[model samples]
Target chain A: MDLTFAPEEEAFRAECRAWLEANVPRGLPSGDTRDGFGVHLEWERALYGARYAVVSWPEEYGGRGASAMEWLIFEEEYYRVGGPQRVTQNGIFLLAPTVFEFGTQEQKDRILPRMAAAEDLWCQGWSEPNAGSDLAGIQSKAVRDDAGGGWRLSGQKTWTTRGAFCTHLFGLFRSDPEAERHRGLTYFLVPLDAPGMTVRGFGRLDGDEGFAEVFLDDVFVPDTDVLGEVHQGWGVAMATTSSERGLTLRSPGRFTATAARLIELRRERADPHDTRLRDAVIRAWTDAEAYRWQTFLTVTRMSAGEQLGAESSMTKVFWSDLDVRMHELALELLGADAEHDDSGWMKGYQFALSGPIYAGTNEIQRNVIAERVLGLPRK
Target chain B: MQFAFTDDQLAFRDAVRDLLARECPPSVVRDAWTNKHGRTDTLWTRLGEMGVLGAALELTDLDLVLVFEESGYFAVPEPIVEHVAVAVPLLPEPTRAATGAITAVTSLEGQGAVAYGNSADVVVAGSDAGVELLEAFEVTTLPNSVDGSRRLGQVSSSGTGSGVQIGDRDVFRRAFDRGALGTAAQLIGLTRRMLDMTVAYVSDRNQFGVPVGSFQAVKHHLADARIALEFARPLVYRAAWSMSEEDPDASVHVSMAKAAAGDAANLTAAKALQCHGAIGYSYEYDLHLFMKRAWALAAAWGDASWHRSRVGRAIL
Candidate 1:
């Protein structure tokens, strides 16, 4: 029930704030969720080197192992500094945990350290052009070699995050056409430079080429490269995908930053005629704070080791959609000023518009809440 | 950090829920907007007696829980939050411990009868003036293109009512936050109910090919409604939770909760009505009953923009 940070945490917060004030970049992210790829990658390395990244991980793994609340303080300051998101998000957020869970001792030794240091750039190869939300629908097939050891893979996985630049790809490939939805898949770790695999780039709404259409053509993979049991790939991928409690890339406070930025954008143009716009700005203000508290509630649930359920789906869905609200208000507030992309606002607006389509579509999250969280039958 | 309500709050919530089902049923709400009198002396007296106006004020933990649940299930026809936020602080220890209103908010425009215009016994809303308790009468309805839940009406108040006027502006606005957070909680309930009602009705109702809900439009819209409700519910609770934490950043949560819940309730209520279609607009249908309450609460205390600005300033 207490909101104030303990004196120690507050002091730690001040220390971090002081550090950021000294070392962090001067300008903010221009409200564009997308950052320049080259700059973002370099920033990721610098952050990891400084140990300011991965606030929740064990210090041995290049993080501060901070308490959940302290981690939030870290994010609040990070956003205040307006630093770029960790460029190797797939490596840090998704794969590192998966490796820790299923990886062999050597695998952990080889990957975890690199992952912690951002030396391992990972791309997700789960979804295909046809498989959209249904991971089981992936037709990208992998077949066993004659020696019955390594496998040869051939298929197309699109919307592969950072596939163009990432060095490794962790993916779900159909190993047996006969196996049912949850049974026949295999999770594999394939180096991007492996023969037959090609990377093709695509543009995001942020105008960055972080996403790519990865074509897997007869790529070789040793048996040890498989993430989990054969024909049990779905289980591994599902566990990884559903690992909601681990790292929260979208901290609750991010909503606050987004809201605040909208207000700043409006304050520069503050005029009496802008009452409606001002009102929208106020709404964004409340929304950001409300959800952060809501997030605070969720964080406590997680800290108490509560199982991940439908309730947390609310945050992902709300934050993304509310983010759109802030932008829509921004667009409305800016009106004619909206077209002035030279100042980076229009780009920000477009980025917001694209948010719902990212992560999981808002529709998918609702289905999860309705069917699983609310215990309602699926339509 | 705990989600569990205190033992007293549990008992109080159960009682409030029980009382609401019997007293201000959706049917009554439906009736009032149509031909029936929305508020009666007895109804008002019962609410006062039940501690509806003062649940958060002076009641025990049990009383707070009761209002939380009440705020969820039944839509309050009056400014119960205003009563709780303004009156609870000023009530006698017995009443305050019981957690009911201690003092009333006074508004210059007075209680308009249509919830916001003159909904408070002591209007605690707005800056410049403090909680303005005025000589008030029952609400008289006016037709409008706006909300169905909030019947717009005009009222004149006697300025002689017992209440204090505020000299400082910040104090006036802070009073509104407590009420705003309370209403946002209610909006969560309303959105959930609307989603439930729409889901139940559509799942059964037949259409061109199959059950109308089987169609993608119905499913997606309901799903979207579900998403809105889910997203809003947490934010609403977050604000409430923050209030308990008494964090200065609570304003962050209050504004966020109000903004998110207001938007979600409006979206969900609209979709719920759309799903019910012809029946939704009819007087006999209960769909509009929820809609009206949602419409009224969405704009209460402050609208989306007001909340957004508070959040914006905090982070920026």
Candidate 2:
């Protein structure tokens, strides 16, 4: 087992660190807000210009076609220099992989470059009022409009992160009403400005307009917008969810950076006598290190042609739980000052709360692990 | 970075696993509890014949860790960690070739008891001064351990002509790290065994006319255990890699692995016992064999808290 990066990988890391150190904007607001979203879009454009936006994607698709190990190194370097969260993640990390895997030449040509450049911001339109955990219970309908050579979408999608700002959405709709849960659904890429569609921004727990409820009333999406086979959206969507829950969405770099920052905070504010809090900080740091190594193992397996299936569920449970615990420890270190502090720990804690709930809840992921990974009987 | 074992390493692991499965079953482990000296001579010789005892002489820490993990999987009642990981590597070339002679090592200062002390033909002790190979030692057997096969005892130099000075302080320090890394690998194996046993029990055992595994609570419990072990395993492997490479941060990495594996094993033991209900609590059940081994190992080299504190000093 070789844990040390090769000279080329280290060189790539050095380049990424230098670029991110110089280019990352100072004092940018949270990307969830309107002002912050615009600034974040500018950063994404800069990243794309440097060919660092989608390092793992093919070169033709505005990426360097970097290896998975290189991509992880890029992430580590990016976060080490305090790079902001990628506001374009829904399109770049989640939907882009699916599109590359299943999208036609036309879709790939029209979608990827713009998504990488943040010219066409996208949001996930999966969870609805009744379909948060049971994603297959989507009530959205896509009726064939033969005359218009398109589909007429009618549905309401809630908890659409940054939907108010995104120009388009990638979601699921029932194309075959007769087919029950998990079947009949077709993946659709709908423009937010499509006729009869409205996005209503709402306050999340953090009191930011980070979420929206998209109401679709007879919105027309042409056949070209369909992703994957019309009725096999479940399989396509699973691929995307796996990306969301696994490597791409949350890199170990993010947690390890947060862990480093937490250590700094402890050094600055922690009570020396509070051994419990000290221990908590240590556990948080080690957990981050553990996650970093785990990701390396996973990337190694993936590079060796192994497919990651239900095991991704274990990844989700671990990092999400670690994220929450790390933030909690940070806040405890801050003590009473945490309540009104603008140090981002409070905001990060609020965001971490959504990790376990989103990307399919931890409970659902555990069921997947037990039944699929462990071969436990499901009654 | 290739963070996986090579094909040769995996082959070695599988070979050891097969050997342990056949030679070191639960009955063999049970026998260690009542057997004189708590030693399985036949299994030891077989392992020696397999070149497992001479592993440190020919293999990297990365390769030897895989063997230690398999030994823990079978709950092999031997001083494999002490002999293979610590004592064997530090022993003189002549002494290292004597694979039949069982060796055990202990820290001279804080260690209260040495595992397999009675069975060991050579006892090595490490301290700030250096490492010493005791010529004649007296073993005072301690009380029966939670893991009956462990066989702990106090070792004192009997024919004290100040035992042979073998290695210096740096050698002892590195040996401690190797011992911890080996134990960490063992803990990961023990954790997997417990989780696997619990998953099987819950899948077959029923409650309210349905398999208890179907209950979300039971599924979540086992799932959490699996998650802990799954994540901790990479740390152990990476620690082995670091030690093999003689990385400057090897001690910190070893501490991380031991801390994580210790926590994962202890947590899995508790969840496995709870999920198995009354049957898991009984001594006759096979689950305790692994559960108790996990408990004893978790506290052996350094408990989770101690290792974490060590890690805390390094990072914080």
The candidate maximizing TM-score is 2
**Candidates' RMSD to native:** 5.0, 1.3
Give DockQ per model, in order: 0.30, 0.87
User: Count of backbone clashes for each model?
Assistant: 58, 0
lDDT of 2 by residue, A126-204 (tens): 9989998999999999999999898999999999999999999999999999999999999999999999999999989
Candidate 1 lDDT tens digits, A1-379: 4444688788879988987778776544421123555566666777778787676777877888888788888888877766555667777777776777787877877777787776777888887898886767889988999695889999999888778877899999889988867678899999999999899987776666757999988999998888878888877776566543222646766668777777787777667456666666666665566566666666667777986665555566767778778777777767786777455457666766756665667677666655565444454
In angstroms, the error of model 2 at B25 is 1.3
- lDDT scores of the candidates, listed in order: 0.67, 0.89
True contacts kept of each: 0.33, 0.88
lDDT of 1 at A352: 67
lDDT value, candidate 2, whole model: 0.89
